[model samples]
Target chain A: MSELRTRMSAAIGTAPVEATRRGAERLAELRRRAETDYPPMGEMRDLARAIRLHTLANLHRYLSEFCESAQRAGTRVHLAADAAEANSIVESILRAAGARTVVKSKSMLTEEIGLNHALDGFRVTETDLGEFIVQIAGDRPSHIIAPVMHRTRQEIGRLFADVLGVAYTDDPPQLNDIARSHLRRRFLEADAGITGANFAVASTGSVVLVTNEGNGRMCTSLPPVHIALVGIERLVPSPAELAVLLEVLARSATGQRLSVYTTVVTGPRRPDEEDGPVETHVVLVDNGRSRVLASEDAEILACIRCGACLNVCPVYREVGGHAYGGVYPGPVGAVLQPALGVGSADLPFASSLCGACREACPVRIDIPRLLVGLRHRLVDRSSFSWLGLGLEAYSRVASNPTAWRLFLSLGSFGLRTAARDGWIGRLPFHASAWTAHRDLPGPGAPPFRVWWRNRNR
Target chain B: MSRLSEFLARIGTARLPSARPEVRAPQLDATDLVSLFIRRLEEVDGVVHRTDPVEVVAGLARRLGTDRYLSWDPDRLPVPGLVAELETLGIERHTGPGREEVPLGVTGADAGLAESGTVVLIAGPGRPRHPSLLPEVHVALLRVDLLHRSLTHWMLEHPQALSEGSGLIMITGPSRTADIEQQLNLGVHGPREVHVVLVGA
Candidate 1:
């Protein structure tokens, strides 16, 4: 592992406890906000759902319209069926532009595809404050929204002072100034810039970048060539629809009026302009998103990249972003990563089915329902053994109440015999991982159905 | 060959039929509309000012240090005499003169939509889309009467707006990003500063 990755992993290993506390506190705060201040999140979530549903149902029409409009606006758009293709196309563009050093804005798609790692042959710099911190440290982002949420200010001060040859200070202003100074030179020196798109307007061929800092502007404009990596589903039919999404995104994510800056870039700079990038190319990455889109559980695409779900998820709140073992984390990641990565059964089991994620979603994605659908997909997999066998056996006994009762009664007798005090200390096989964390409750002596039948009689 | 065509194929493959959806749409009001637009800008450390459009430009000019600027429109000032008053400060107007040479860029607004706190600029005849983006400073003139509470409202108001093949920029604030080491930097690529001058009749 690279020094950064190792440090990140070590730091991540220690984060579960701290993250557990912070995540719990954040969840409580959010719940309190939901109850007292923003009581209408559930309602707003529904409206977001309706808007996304309308867009997705007729995605073809909207996407084509967006492309036509974007093309007319003078943007060259490339679609990649997966991450590799997306990276390849982007790399090719960078090479053609004669770019050696690239300054980038925070883009999860780039993280997912390991774009920076692929650019190891060249110099690639991350400009988003959170992304930049993690980039210099050579660590993967720990949080979807706040990549350096795992690190304390002291740790960051050390990292910057050590790596960038700047004075070390835990103070935010001092830190901010140092970062600004370091990046200013890169912005001027870079030959190309890369960013992730918040939304792409099919009707106007405009890419909307919502940010707090102004780095995205530099990354897009400072270089001669600008490239954007956007998910395929990030398209809204018109700027009007795009505007609605921008409104809800900030409020739900950070409770702000708007991000510090919102820039709508259409194609490249015109001949008369002095500063903006001369070339603009947008890479629309499918990267298994298209596969999920085709599935009956396609609502996952409606995600606006808001991290609200992670803040509220009981499991995510406990383990943090690193434990999810992917670029995305939390309820959204539990569903998205497996769908986007590989059709693996182990990934979907990451959720606890608490439905807190769905409750917090601005776009009102029924994450629990999708998670259940993923379980079915996993079960259908040819490699699925234990779950498939268990469910298949369950169907036979479940058909008859009498048979089910007998089977449960017999199983209860055996479990009780095996029980130590009130709990089963450990299981011999697949169930062992569960007991590692918490004890499993022993089955009661008398079966509930039998006791209820006797009492009623 | 086109990204759109490839995107279409991906979309075609991902389309699945829905059985039933349990969620319902929520009722929206005007306050929700206002809050939504204001909220996105505020989170990223942006400021929102509500004032007469004429005062808006003057206020922004004061913040930017000088009244001298180059604008796309000939009749940009809310009152015809306002530009003449500022003209002593070298507030030169440009039809398509070299925009790169100007420190401040002033352009007429196409529409000021309230949905995203965005002032839309439609680059029509004589204006190249690039000038609006490349300047160190950009000052947009947004008409207050043109402000709509919702993006849908704005779209309905201008049905052929996006299809006009003109450059339409929905600028919320100065160009910015937090990508490098997550530190916020201003004036990186596009304009270092963006001030919207809201003009009212």
Candidate 2:
């Protein structure tokens, strides 16, 4: 079996069914509410797509503008060419500040770069409730938006009991209170906080963060030092463009007109300010984004990490996110993983090409087209394979009428003999791969050409 | 080459599509913005109270059921004589950060977005981010005139609002989460209850 298939089967076998059902229901409810709340949703998506594409096409100009404006606003901006460089720069920042305890809001970029592992000696706590639970349980987040979507309340109740020495209870609000009291203390005492930017406005030199929970605000506001790990592609030209993207992001992500908190942090706190971080650092991590920018699949960079595609994906619904085995999951992950050169070659073929993701995407990414393009690229890269040989031979025969007719007749004969009650329950040898999952339809007794000839008689 | 230059050079200048898309703001009844704001805010689990400025402040203090609360500086609030009103109600206000035990936190909003029922709060010397964040219940005092149709409308009118402070936050409702078994839970990390007092209404 392929590695993807194995992981998928394992995920399907183990993932709590009730949790997945509940998560899907909630997502459906949100999507329904979003349609009513935002009346001009289609126009908003077009505007968002245009803004993202324009930003990427002119990234250098905007990035330079962003760095200069950020510096002038008292934010220290660092440029990292890769993950190693990004991690080292963050380490130095923490080292200089003598920060020992760090609280982090949900940042997939940090997870991508493995920032926590680099800070071996320092105490790092994931402050977001979902992320906090994922941290203490020593697990990777399964979903982009809702990290612990696969875990049940009962399991979380047990995790809290086991990890925090608290009594076990399956009620969600009580569990939330326990985490709230615990993380609140960490928020007040943590030396530093790190978060990811949803959108970084180039004109104002501000990092925009959207979150339903206020942990994003808590992390950026309370700590003495704040570090934001931003992907280079996260830049928007100005607040006007930022507004367009924000209009679609929350609605697409969780079906809200806006998240509970949408924060825009321009720089460190002023000398007279009583709250907010004393020092702010913005790390622009390019980790292979330029390569993606110069590729045919550059539009994948326009994705806002909304996970709307995942909610509507049939394949993701069946196997869940952990099967994809990447920081990003679902249809977007299939294209993005290979685009970033981090995923297996088979990731692109993990979809049914349903076109649901394209419809659901707020930025209107043509994910199906990108998936097919990646599949073509993967086939071109391979020098020799059974699939390649078979396709080459099949194409030659398909072009020749006589050979095509002969091959179809032979195939029909073999399929007709194997049919039991007009259904091929199982086939012999390598063809059984299809029968293993589903029965194949029996071919007609007379081939299509023969039937055509007989029809005229 | 510097790191920034190297990064920029790799993202080389290529002739790219440059058509900027324009977004048309939805038509809204300007005279009825206050009602729109109230309804939108209520949709997201936020409370709206319509009362005169001074009466509202006193009412909030009295209903808080606690002596001490966090707040932004009185002079920055929309209502005049807020400090006197709170004093009359005997409510002790902590303007600085680090008072986590305070049950209520009150502040004046920079602007209120009618489209999403969002209140924009900018952080500055006298206006800290804590009052709106740290307490169990957050009460925002918004003037009727400060309400705008949406985020885009507000940005187009007040572009410099982004540059005025170290940070600005648009809070639509109270802090909430649905991470545990996808069940909705309020007040995970921030205030559970958010109340907006329309001063001029």
Candidate 3:
């Protein structure tokens, strides 16, 4: 346990205040531009929620419609029930295209599935600047929205100098241009471009991508064969519904009036076009979400992956996204990780249940409620072994007044005995994870419950 | 593969097995409706205009530097005099031609959606799809009334009008990118500037 803590601490060195502060400043300035340029936040949130809900409700129908329509438009539609299958389908398509090198944008789902590692035969480059930085650093993203949010500018400058064979500077503009010149060639040369879908319209057989970077357009259009790995829940019924989602997605993600590039592609480029991709493939990945969709947890599908919930979260603000140790982090990640059946129970417990995430979410997903629900699932199924079973027992006792009182009195005596040398330090092994950070306050001379009982007597 | 197939079959055959009870729809108001449309259009980086048709043309000319306007017909324009005025301002005039020869293209918007400030345009004989995308400066003549309250409203009215089998570009603004260290570079692959001329009540 100590080793794990040490590993995490070592992995996440203190964010260089000056560099991180500058990054945050840039993000804030960009956010301001987005807010000024995009529509009102409150209105966008409402529409986003509506469109998400409507899509979730009719997901299967829309997915079927989208598949049928895309097939008619000369694009192949493959359904992947899980991440492994999704990756395999893409690998097969790329192999068929004889793709030696591939260019990609930052996709959380692909990260969740560890797709880059799975591409054994091909060289894949994540073209998004933050992703590229993280890729070169040989580190995982700590934040969902900004993968390298923990890195200082000086660190990035060092990374670029080492990896790209260029002199390093902490200047943001210079770094940007360097990355642009580096990636521009990949955008033109790559045989296949892979992307994650923002929204897939079943009505029009179209995939809508909202990107501040134009890489998404080039990645989709420049290559001969284009592959989109989309989660099943990403489907909307029509183009009209897609419009509603676009309203909220930009503001929620970056506070933009609208993203600079919103591309709606139905199929491959027509024969007349000089530059569009010749083939388009949409891979709908279920991964474990269909079970979530089938269960009472279907609302989890309404997530737009805007990462707003992370921004407002107190825990995430302190620990950062990398601490969660998954592709997702914060409130949405807490609920989603388990539903996607990706990782263990530790992620669901990584929250304070303060409800700020629910408030911050544009779709107003009751994340706390969902967390509690997941906790119930975790506790009930005894899926978490001894720790979960202990919690289940505690919950049963806590629900009853007499049992709770009796248990507290006994526990209080143990706490009083455990306190020595005017301090209660070094908890038993199970509780060590908490005590490692701060000392627990000693129990009072007499339990409050004992005094209450005496007073009543 | 077999294991995956079995899993997918289970997902496909699985009924709605959720224990969650149905929730009554929340009361959504007009402001909620308008903001929803506006946010979506804006996220796609569209510009909204509230001026009259005559004023919008002036805005267009001013934005594009009163250059030569290459378009289909002068009579179809809301302000007939503005065409000659643009020509006088040294804006070149021409009908739809091959995209290679067309540097600046002007065409009519099918409808103006107020929700996101999006003006819909469909490619036809007079309007080449290439100019809507390929030109250095692409301008659309939009109408005010076509502004939709919501995407739902648009769908309810037009149904599947947006589904283009070959090409469908629902453009919100000038093509832009943040790929280079998240710095915005406008006119990367598409038009550098998108000028909108609102032409109606």
* Ten contiguous residues minimizing lDDT sum, candidate 3 chain A: A16-25
Candidate 1 lDDT over A79-189, as tens digits, reads 787778888898899888888999999888898888888888779989877788888888877677767766777888999999999887987657766776687678778
**What docking class should model 2 receive?**
medium
User: Which ten-residue region of model 2 chain A has the weakest summed lDDT?
Assistant: A13-22
CAPRI-style quality class for the chain A–B interface of candidate 1: incorrect
For model 1 the TM-score comes to: 0.75
lDDT (Cα, tens digit) per residue for candidate 3, span A1-457: 4432443354443553223334444554555566555444566566567667666665656667788777777778887766788899999999998998998877877987789999978989887777888888888876666677667667788889998999979776577767766886787678999988888888678877766545676677667888888887888776656666766676667665446556667787765554567888988888787778777666777898887777767666655665565678767888887877765565666678998888767788989888888888777786458876788999999999999988988888777777776567878977877788887887876667667879998
lDDT of each: 0.68, 0.88, 0.67
TM-score of each: 0.75, 0.95, 0.73
Ranking by lDDT: 2, 1, 3
Candidate 2, superposed: residue stretches over 4 Å from native: A395-409, A416-423, A440-456, B13-16, B27-31, B53-64, B95-98
**Model 3, range B94-176, lDDT digits (tens) per residue?**
54334334456566666555545555665333443454554557777666566665433564577566564344444667766
What CA RMSD would you report for each candidate?
A: 6.4, 2.2, 6.6
Tens digit of per-residue lDDT, candidate 2, span A1-457: 7898888777774656346646855785697689776667777788888899988889989999999999999999998989999999999999999999999999999998899988878999998899999999998887889999999889999999999999999999999999999999999999999999999989989998998999999999999999999999999998888887898898888888889999899999998888999999999998988989988888999999998898888888888878898799899999999999996779999999999999989899999999999999888888888987888999999999999888887888888989999999999889888899999989866667778999999
Q: At residue A210, what lDDT does model 2 achieve?
A: 90
In DockQ, how does model 1 score against the reference complex? 0.23
